[model samples]
Target: MDSNWGSSSNLDSEWEEHRRQMMEEDEEDDARMRTNTQLTATAATLWTQEQIQQEGPWGGSVVGRSNKRRGRALGHQKLMMDYFVPNPIYTLENFRRRYRMRRHVFLHLVNDIPNVNPYFRQTTDATGNLGFSPHQKLTSALRMLAYASLADQINESMRMSESTSIENLGEFVVQLFTRTRMSTFDNQHMRT
Candidate 1:
């Protein structure tokens, strides 16, 4: 019974020592957390201030850059008004026959058409030149787009509607040559 009491007293003292150690660990953890929190807050505030400084008052410099960019764009648009062809129809057969290239090579060229045409005719006069009205521009843009849509059918790239395809291709260059000869004959007859 005395030995049992002695062991209980020893356990009580050890438990008190363990409790003190736990309290010290808790204090250290809290101090570390508060320091981390303060550092995080300071970093965030500095970042916000730097952002404000770079942005300036009401983001005036950014607004100025955007306005200048817009003006340059408008100026480029104005330059497109001279020597612009409207909805220019490119005859693939004429290109193929003229260049004496294979049909497959011609198709590749045709695929490159839409991208090239816009750049070539981007700027023109309002009178159906490059600087088109909203509707004309839209139509021209559509024509440019149609090249890609029709590229599949063109030069046997893919199957497509036959009637529509023929019309889109326009008359063969041979026919144009024949018509030119006939017109020249008529002009010569009128001169006689």
Candidate 2:
């Protein structure tokens, strides 16, 4: 009976010591977590302050665009056809025969069309290469109208993407309609 009591007393002392150590470890873990949380909060606050200082009061620049060419620049290369004759596709004789117009008339159209539709203007890209020039756009439209060619077929020789060729074709039609309407019709309508 005395031996059993001694063993129980020993176990009780060891258990109490272990419990105390576990509690200390738990407290240390809690302190470490609080420190980490505070560090994270401080970092986030600093980041926010830096962002505010960088952007000034509100987002976007107070002044206008940084330069004249600010945000305006072509993003793709589609104007290579500006002076490309396409060997046999767009030769002088072929153009005249296919479009049913003289070379001079075609040239005149090319010059005048871009005056009305700014979409056909030659654009300089930021990296390199100028996007579709007026002549290329006009040629694309003319070929589409004359040959009833698909955008894919036109893109093959023009070096333009299919979507761009289609978009240019649509713009070309609108400009042509405006020109034809102004030229063919009287400025003042006749009163009934």
Q: Model 2, residue 100: what's the lDDT?
A: 70
Query: lDDT tens string, model 1, 1-192?
Result: 999999999999999999999999998997797566556445434544454455455512353343222232343344233222242243546434533554456345334443534422235433343332222222222232334234223323212222322322222222223444566579779999
| lDDT (Cα, 0-100) at 21 in candidate 2 | 100
In model 2, the clashing pairs are none
The global C-alpha lDDT for each of the candidates, from Candidate 1 onward, is: 0.41, 0.61
For residues 56-133, what per-residue lDDT tens digits would candidate 2 score against the true structure? Answer: 554234577442231112312333232334543356776568667876787787777667777877876565746666
Best by TM-score: 2
lDDT of 2: 0.61
Best by lDDT: 2
